[model samples]
Target chain A: MRQILSQFGTDCDSGAAPRTMENWYEHREMIEINIVVCIKQVPGTTEIKIDPQTNTLIREGIESIINPFDTYAVEEAVRIKERIAQQSKEGFSGPESKVIAITMGPPQAENILREAISVGVDIGVLLSDRALAGADTLATSFTLAKAIRKLEREFGKISLILCGRQTLDGDTGQVGPELAQQLNLPCLGYVIEVMEIDNKYFKLKRLMEDRYEVFRVPLPAVISVSKGINEPRVPSLRGAMRAKSAPITVWRVSDLDVKSEEVGLSGSATQVIKVFSPHIERQSEIFTGDVDTQVEKLTQKLQSLGVV
Target chain B: MDYFLSDEQKMIVDIARKIAQEKIVPVRKELDEKEEFPHEIIKEIARADLFALFVPEEYGGLGGRIFDVCLAVEELSKGCLGVATSYAASGLGFLPIIISGSEEQKKKYLSDLASGKKLAAFGLTEPDAGSDASAIRTSAVLDGDEYVLNGTKQWISNGGEADIYTIFAMTDKTKGARGASTFIVEKGTPGFSFGKKEEKLGIRASVTRELIFENCRIPRENLISREGMGFIIAMRTLDKARPAVGAQAVGVAQAALDESIKFAKTRHQFGVSISSFQSIQHMLADMATQIEAARALVYAAAKMIDSGAKEISAASSMAKLFASDVAMKVTIDAVQIFGGYGYMREYPVEKMMRDAKITQIYEGTNQIQRNIIASHLLKSA
Candidate 1:
């Protein structure tokens, strides 16, 4: 589904549809959303090729993609905005909603920012600069919180933040919660189902280790989505064409009102000294015989291993 | 993914996903439990202007290509088969009027049905005659300015909820299939009463009931074509509706495959996710392969129809058979992957499996489809 994001406070029925950006603060339905999507652009899995010599992933010739899980996060934010806008039109113009997708990556990461626009996001911000590179979870959150503050200055106050539970490449589920902490937003992790969201609060059903928990979090909260929260809609052709030229706002550390020392490697609390693939042992014993013989052999092996 | 939907096709999928998730998804369980028709969802679909897709633009319809319709049906069925089938049967009921109805008839019925102001149903199957639709027991006797219809039609989708019904009955009893004729039966006619609704294994939200025509009379203009062309019209209609049923089945199977793949990757069973095991991986690969194959055939059949191609009995039957069978297999495997949890009502996959089983039985059962394929192959030889 296409997501729609507009600012709160404008009278939509009073010919304000065309001039959405200027008077967004007037439409109440466009108001309380602080949709901060922590998105990252990585190599497309299908486009990635393996280097035969070093057993490493070849980055060249591979097209970059917005992390698969993060797309759902952006979509959920857009959906919330659309719901609010639609509801506002039906006389419940309480507090409005806005979707702002924020990413911390290289300059080229702006492509995914535009992609998010095609999915119905209103604003895109790229946190880029030499000082923002090589940041760990702590520094990433610190940089993101600064960007959020700047977004608040431009679009008024924000109420909700959303992000993917983990990026595919990093596989670290820490960034979303850490970013929530930096912004002082109440955080809900592994949210599989979003039951309802009104102006003041939103209810969510989060998947836990053994059972699911339903919680109602106040505004200015953070939620990270797991896969299967909802099926992500494909981008429309018109949306994709429009996204091709969508302007993406870029921000450096100086623009975000952050101390230079509070970013990059300096602000990071944890650092990986070395990176290597884990060793996997494989000792194959072929059972080339009748099915009964193979079964018997398998049973004997299981018994010997104390698995039976 | 590339095998099924193109970049353009994905747009339709996106719209369908939005509609399914926002409009249809919320009411699915309640509609099923209450056995209530999704009147609101239908209005929303019409508001989106999707119902008129098959109708030509000259008739104030969207005139969308068949592939687009399939994409829409597939996505909608993923949310709930009953609702999707109810929406899809509009095309089945209206196609006859579109292909053969006069401009006046099109203006009178198609416009309202397409605009979502009224519902329509197709009445071809009787309790005694389902696979053998030629053996219709309903008889329509023409007397000067009117034809009186008297018989019962079973398993009519949309049944009493429809404002208009395209009915098939025997005009001349001696002529077998050729003697059959089609008529448009408007609701509120005297002697027209609905029978008890059928409680089925799946597609529960859609109303399927028998229509009893006791001396029901309509103007001679209500006849869709000449007195002896109902069988041909119905056969042609099935050629189109069969592919749509295939699309619905593929949607159900796709939902199963997606859920299974996600569960396999996360649910651990022996110190690791089951997806990491070769046995589970092989199951997923097989399910994916079948889905791709079925999708290809369904789209191919749909494209052929959109191109205004001649009769393609073999292609339609093959697509329906492959898709329905794949739905059965994929859903079974999905249930197995979820272990005991899959059989529970809380999970969506179990319901999808139940929904998938009916596609094999309806729109010309897979058995009948196989017969059509075999006959076509032998005749060519």
Candidate 2:
């Protein structure tokens, strides 16, 4: 898998290239750093409950969590806002940074978005409608990009877009990069550490297979975070109480000022033709012997499978 | 600290109960019989960020007050008391160092423990000192820069699996309670080993073993309180921990009552369900009432602990005594309600009945609790 991915690795691996020169803080005397963290609500796993009688998913009892990976994205956005607020207080007075969490899922996902707000995000927006039920990655990205643009129009120009590396249910790792591509934003993936940040630029350590590469990405860049990007903090009791009634803005395709054909099934490029449980076959041969004999048997077994 | 929980407590309770009922109920029997610890369940709870409820925020903990831990304990225990007790004891073994340790100790231990990378065990009850903990014969002799500990602690929960331990040993054997001191002994010390695992009748899934410290040497910094403050420190830790035990009892009792009620209404006897019998109905009613009342006391004690009230010890003892006794009674009644089937191992109520028995034995027996309550009463007199 590593070799396969590395075969397609682009200049994205280059630590140089200076992706964007537009530094918001240096350009304007100040810039409002509005961040929209794109999150998704997905069935946490493929092993979902099926109603035996109906041969359909029992959605009522099923749980929809904030895509597990997205939590790190939401956390990073909130953390950056906190860092900005603290920096501003320490006479590094910059325009106040704000984190607005946006999720495109069913209306029930409002709960998770509200949870994000409780964990110190400034605002929450949910894009939900019956039309978005069968969205593939491409359509999901299009819908999210439009929603981000709409948010920029209503709030302000968002400087940073953050998301998880991939959703647990999808595992495609395409939505975040696709969204960034649609927005024409420079995208960085597998961020492990946020080393330092001022208003205009942020230094981060992007995790690679063998080592970590440090990069100073300019503002407005979309960064996909891996897990272990600093342990996500739990919401305090007071924070949870505040989140219980947090206002969540709901949107639809019409709200995003986008064409309906660019969403849902019509907008999808790829379709899953069929899904079935994979057949698993297991065979075991017990090697009964002393240590030397056992080692010989193991080596023979590995060689038999072309693994040694 | 207030008796009324903020909305967070209620929400946690709701989530935990749903997971317990929907996820844990079906698999609990198999897990128990096979003696398989549910590592995945603990991982799920960890993902929920439950393991840090008591540690302060600076140490990467949630800094949730004692009340929240108790509330969560009750809910989690309802799923499986063994798991809940093991999880909650993580707090018990760490909260002391968190609440009283020097900054160096806090930085050294709290973060790792809070992150669930390490498990902690609290050691105070020795074989001879189960009820009268002042009778502990374990001695910690200051030798050069190290303290040599030699003792045996019995029935220590998480004994075999713990990475760190909060141990109490006598620094001056003559002074009884005053001469005892607390020490934080990391596992894998040369002389710190555990005995065979206890084959428990209840909570068998939770690892319990005898902790043996034979000249286990630790740095001087491992000492928790001042040289003579061991008993006082141990008491303080128990004051915080007792309510959690009570909450565990409540969880066990609540599970029993719920299962019993469900069974009674469905299981028919004499062509008319036993639930229709006035006597059986009375038992169910009593069980429900007892569980609710025990819950109230447990929550109240938890609130008292959180508030830092002077009455905390008394309240904790009251809650522990009442709730655990209620668990014993309620579980027995639940088993009785099941009639012949309740005696069978297949029914969940039977396991609940077995599991509920240990709540009275640990966290200071009900007799010791009464003694503490009586002491508080007589002291005022």
The TM-score that candidate 1 achieves is 0.59
lDDT of 2 by residue, B235-307 (tens): 8888888988999999999888888889988988799888899999899889888888998998888887777
Q: TM-score of chain B only, all predictions?
A: 0.96, 0.95
Write model 2 residue lDDT over A77-127, tens digit each, in one string.
888888777655543356577899988777788988877876778898998
CA lDDT, every prediction?
Answer: 0.82, 0.82
Q: Which stretches of candidate 1 lie over 4 Å from their true place?
A: A1-308, B3-8
Provide the lDDT at B174 for model 1.
Answer: 100
- Report clashes for each candidate as comma-separated counts: 20, 1
Candidate 2 — which residues are off by over 4 angstroms? A1-109, A115-125, A128-308, B1-4
Single out the weakest 10-residue window by summed lDDT for candidate 2 chain B.
B40-49
Q: TM-scores across all candidates?
A: 0.59, 0.66
Candidate with maximal lDDT:
1
Candidate 1: RMSD to truth: 11.4
For model 2, which pairs clash? A159-A220
